[model samples]
Target: MIQLYDSFHQASKDLYYSLTQAGFQGPVVVINDDGFLPEGVTSAYSYYCQMETGQGRSLYFNQLQVPPFWEITGTNGDGEVWDYSQRKAKIFYAEPKHLRRIKNVDWFGPNEKVRFTDHYNRFGWLFARTYFNAEQKVTSRIYFNQAKQEVLVENFMTGDIQLNWQGKVYFFDNRVELFRHYFAEMGWELSEIWYNSLSTPFFLSYNSPEAGQDILFWQEGIQEDIPGNMKVMLNSSHVRTQRVLVQQRQVYQKMMDILPEEQKAKIAYLGYIYPSLRENAGRKEILILTNSDQIEKLEELTQALPDFHFHIGALTEMSQRLMAFEAKSNITLYPNISQKQLQRLFQECDIYLDINHSGEVMDAVRKAFEQNMVILAFEQTIHNRDLIPAAHRFDASQPTDMVMALAGFAASYPQMVALQREETSNESVTGYQQLLGKEER
Candidate 1:
């Protein structure tokens, strides 16, 4: 059986599903340090144990008590190929069915840092990071010299290699277009690509399969702006990587729940999108500070609430478009509010409504909370769970409930005021401290 290196996340589910959809039938194993998994999962999950193959047509990998080396074996002639030099052992068979359960054996080795199998798909073969030492940060250095079967054992390994010398290598890229170009240039063989959201040189390469059989392995840290089904090919294999993936897994069904087919027929009968009773002008002073992409949506909202004046701040051309629309709608636009000016606006406004959750917005809200200002926001996600109090949350879909909630908040001025201040003053996380210890810098 080909060993697939999967990180414990939502995408693993997607990848497993994709493979199953492609008619590959086999037991899927999900492993993690914590061993916590979702309900209805059947795979074997374990923690704190080493893996290996046991005796008889069985696959065995043993975890030793101490470091330096471990042993794995496949009896019944599966083939015991060991690269003692690289400290990697491979059990290969022409047919996958001949192998038995892939047993986990305990192992402790000072020299074993990273190890995993090479995978060759319809796209191509790629080596993925299966297991690595957390304390040992391998340098950007890979050492190999005109060899194909032998891998050099090293403490620090790095470099840009098309393939590793131990018959394992990877051609990793983020850009889809660039990947497609390169794949064509390299004669179109099976290869896997690694992608992340660094906004660096990564995240632009993809090789669109001519067969239209692209399978999406959802990676961690992907945002909502990228649609759930955007990269997912229909009737394909899939996996989910993190908690956010759980949210996406249900987004389509949840949206359907929000707007049923019957409601669609009556949308036009309601005349205006929103009712007039609650659409009164100037009911509350709304301070809207957005970074530009959301300006036009805010403008439409301004049209709906004609009485309430708008003070908009944006940073892009699209934000400028919001400015033009606001002018036509007779609303005020603060095109570029400085940080100090924004703080003052927060102080003066009756309600603070940002587009969605944001780190900078959270800081602003914290300031507002400290000043005893009322803040309204959509349902919280993991990112802002710690920042928001239960009392200040408003539903995104239920405008009537949201308005009622806001009104209730307004009537109860200074409600939880002390609590809000206390929460704001609580110690918070700092990225600088997270990346580097206070003493290191």
Candidate 2:
């Protein structure tokens, strides 16, 4: 009896049917965070990776629980090799405190609670390894086939699934799809997947009807415009396209308030002037603090902006570790910082550089503007208008071009900084209203 654990609804259903059809005489358990356990199952567990069991590993009403599980035998979504030993350690140490464990095997009960992570990666391999390491027992590997547009079918315990491309297999995490696509391009068949919260409906909030409808629009839009039969397994709950624009305005305005009375009244260029003074030519090291998702793209820009120093910051400890591994010699890489420290940094920078964005970028801009910093941005970028004030705009395509432009505004840096503060503090709710209008209409 092979135990196949999965979480996605439609894909899980497909795997269950496929496994049963393959003549596996065991139960397929579908565990989820919403306290959802399939009916007629023996018991529920928190996660598949932890070694908690029925007796000691109890949740609400005596349910058994396990730690989080992830598949680690293949390349990861970020196009990097996964550290399996570290991943196994993460599996063991990261488990919830309530569950107990012996050597392996986790257990839960009828009324016990379950746990789930926001993302699932490497779950298939993790479970397979867990069962294999424990009692030499194994189940199967199920996944999607990109080229054929089908799922790969195979049983891992007997190594039956090895290299044999059968029918289509479900991919629980789209990141896994990314991993598979990247590795498959290199002629490697990466097995295993971690299914996340796609089996059931998941949105940012239950109350926003407009947000829900807008997501539907992006989903359909992606399907129609984007080629290929690739399925969109998940999407953000709300449309965050204009948030950066609003923040840029707020930050620029706030900067003006913090300026000296005379500095505030300086009669200089009002909108998007390039720096000219030797002292104000962004000579000070400028850091663009940002999250993990933007790091890859930002790294490319840094290569072009050789005159400007660059730094990277990610929101998570995991990302920090990854950044440490990827950090360059001259570039500073810091772990996540508090909002207070971030605002202080903004004040210290001569030039506040921000990526044109839809969501969190606005928050960063608003913080910078409140500290009275001069901002630089691309003129024609899509979200540039929403995230960056027109007064600070610059040509973003080439860094050499921007440096030449900045040399002109160096002498007028004070004026630009003051303008930023004034723009950020203006209380007109026009931008917010515009954002609301999009979702509302």
Model 2 whole-model lDDT (C-alpha atoms): 0.35
Error of 1 at 93 (Å): 50
Candidate maximizing lDDT: 1
Can you tell me which runs of candidate 2 are displaced by over 4 Å?
1-283, 293-307, 317-330, 337-344, 356-362, 379-387, 398-401, 421-441
The residue-by-residue lDDT of candidate 1 on 135-162, one tens digit each, is 5543432222222222222222432224
Per-model TM values vs. the true structure: 0.30, 0.30
Indicate the TM-score of model 2. Answer: 0.30
- How far residue 437's Cα lies from its native spot in candidate 1, in Å, is 27
- For residues 14-74, could you state the per-residue lDDT of candidate 2 as single tens digits? 3343333333334333333222233333212222222122122212211113344423221
RMSD to the hidden true structure, all candidates: 23.3, 20.7
Q: Give the Å shift of residue 440 in candidate 2.
A: 35
Off by over 4 Å in 1: 1-284, 295-309, 315-321, 328-330, 356-362, 380-383, 416-441
